[model samples]
Structure formats: structure tokens, C-alpha cells
Target: MKRVLTEAELKDLLQAQPEWKLQEGKLIREWTFSNFLGSMAFVNRVATIAEEAGHHPDIEIHYNHVVLALISHDAGGITRRDAAMAAKISTELASHTSPKHE
Candidate 1:
């Protein structure tokens, strides 16, 4: 059965996701892009992942910044699933920021 994550567990998870933070009782991460198109591309990629995982995030995109919040309404709060998604997002952002080799 799915369960809500405890404070200690949340802290441990957050340690690995340095870009994400606990904001107003929610797990959130912010990203900045070079342009609106870049921000939208990131959002679309995140949307696809969320849909595949059957989990959705609260997203806000403005200019070149995108803020993402992850919470499980069905679980009544944060869960392992939320942490996992955050980790995945962190990885994706890292890759996105990396210089491409060609």
C-alpha cells in the first residue's frame, strides 16, 4: 500500500535533489531556460513523463522560468512516488544543462 513520506525520509530524498526545495509544504523545483520555446519544450517533456507515470505536477511557466510542484492528492501528501519523480526531473535537468557533444 502507498504511504505518505515522513519528515526524515523527505529530508533524505531532498538531499539528492538539491535543485528542489520544500516550499509552502510542497516539493518544488524551478528551472530557467534561454527562451520561451525552451521552457515550453521542457514542459512538454515533463508532461509526457508525468502522463507515463500516472502522476501529475503543478507547473507554472513564465518567460524562461518553470516551477514544478509534486504532491500526491490521493495519498494525502508527499510519497515515494513524488521523490522518485523529483529525482527523475533532476536528472533530466542535469542532462538538459549539459553541453552537447557532436
Candidate 2:
């Protein structure tokens, strides 16, 4: 099983990933787009990234808003893998042509 991160480690992770937050045992991030189509496009890209990483996040979509929460179920908490996945997602978003938020 994957190793869960310690509180200290999680703190460091949060510092490195300022866009994400720790909430209810999950690492989460949210984004807002200009329209529903933009939101769906972002979600689709996330789907591909999740598949490639094999770490799917719980997703919530509300029109132009989207939220993703990731946790390592096997490890029973946040893990290094989760942090890495978050970094990948951030990197992907960084390359997007349009600003992620409205």
C-alpha cells in the first residue's frame, strides 16, 4: 500500500501547492471558468490527466465552477502520490491558453 503523508509533510506539500487546500482528509482545488463549455473542457483535460496518473479525484461541477478533491483511498489519507498528482494538474492548468478563473 502507498504510504500516507505525515502532518508535517502535508504542511510542506501545502506550501508547495498553494492553489490546493487540505480539507476533510482530502487535497482539493477549485476553478471557475467563463462559461459551461469552458468548465467542461477543463474537466475533460482533468479526466485525461487523472487517467494517466491513475489517481482520480472526486469532481464536482456546477455550471462554470469546478472542484476536485483527491485522496489516496488505499493509503487512507493524503500521500506523496497525491501531491505529485496535484502538481501535475497545476502544471497542466498553467499551460492553458485562457486564465483558469473568470
Candidate 3:
């Protein structure tokens, strides 16, 4: 089973992925788009990413805003796998229209 990230590792994750926040034992990030279509487009990208990595994140869609939380439930908290997935998602989105972070 995957282990929870160490304090140092968590710090590194936060540093590397500044947009992501360590909240309630999960890595969370939120984005706001110009419209609902824009939000859905971003969500589709995330879906493909999560499927490829086999790391599904809890997704919340509220019109043009979206929130994603990554956690390794089996590990009982965030792990290296979650961090890696976060990086992947960020990289994928970087090539597209810039995400409006909140």
C-alpha cells in the first residue's frame, strides 16, 4: 500500500505545485473559466489525465468554477502518487488555455 507523504515531501509537493493546497488530508486545487463550456473542457482534460494515471480525483463543478481534490484513499491520505498526478495535470493544462486559479 502507498504511504502518506512525509513532512519534507509534503513541503516539496507544495513548493513544486504552489497552486495545490494540502487540505483535509488531500491535495486540492480550484480553477475558474470564462464559461460553463470552458469549465467542462478543463474537466474533460482532467478526466483523461486521471484515467491514464489511474488516480481519480474528486471533482466539483459549479458552473464556470471547478475544484479538484487528490487523495490516496487506500493510503488514508495524500501520497507521492497524488503529487505526481497533480504535476501531470498541471503540465497538461499549461499547454492549453491558462487556467484561472483561485
Candidate 4:
């Protein structure tokens, strides 16, 4: 099973993902898209990634805004898996120009 990330390690990992915020033992990010369709597109992409990695995140969509919070429930907090997923999502976002962070 995956282990929870140590405070130091979490701090370091978060440094590399400046857009992600650590909140309540979860790695969180808020994304703003051009519109509802654009937001749904981003959600679909995230779903594909989650399926590929076998790690899913809690997603909240509000019109043009999408919020993602990732945590390893089995590990009881954020883990390396969460960080890795966040990195993958970040890379995916980098490839798109429609989604601007809010």
C-alpha cells in the first residue's frame, strides 16, 4: 500500500507544483476554462489520466471552473501517488491553452 507523505517531502513536492495547494491533507488545484464545454473537456482528460494511473481525484465543477483535490484515502493522506498525479495533470494542462488557472 502507498504511504502518506511526510511533511518535509510534501513541502518539497509542492514547491515543484506552484499552482497546486496543499489543503486538509489533499493536493488541490483550481482551473478555469473558457466555458462549460472547455471545462468538461478538461474533466474528460483528467478522467483518462486517473484511469491510466488508477488514482482518482475528487472533482468539482462550477460552470467554467473546475477544482481537483487528490489524496490517497487508503494511505490516509497525501502520498507520492498524489504528487505524481498532480504532476501529470500539470503537464497535461501545460499542453492546453484554453484552461487558465484562477
Would you list the C-alpha lDDT of every candidate in the order shown? 0.82, 0.88, 0.89, 0.87
Instruction: Tell me the tens digit of each residue's lDDT in model 2 across 42-88.
Output: 99999999999888999999998889898999999999999999999
lDDT of 2: 0.88
Q: Which candidate's TM-score is highest?
A: 3
Give TM per candidate: 0.88, 0.92, 0.93, 0.92
Give the root-mean-square deviation of each candidate in angstroms. 4.6, 2.2, 1.2, 1.5
Q: In candidate 3, what are the lDDT values of residues 8-97, reduced to their tens digit?
A: 999999999998998888999988888899989999989998998888999999999899999999999998899999999988897664
Sort the candidates on lDDT, descending order. Answer: 3, 2, 4, 1
Clash-forming residue pairs, model 3? none
> Candidate 3's C-alpha lDDT?
0.89
In angstroms, the error of model 4 at 25 is 1.3
TM-score of 2: 0.92
> Which has the better TM-score: candidate 2, or candidate 3?
3
Which residue pairs in model 1 clash with each other?
none
Q: Which candidate number has the best lDDT?
A: 3
Candidates in descending TM-score order: 3, 4, 2, 1
Write down the RMSD of candidate 3 (Cα, Å). 1.2
Model 4 off-target regions past 4 Å? 97-102
Error of 2 at 17 (Å): 0.5
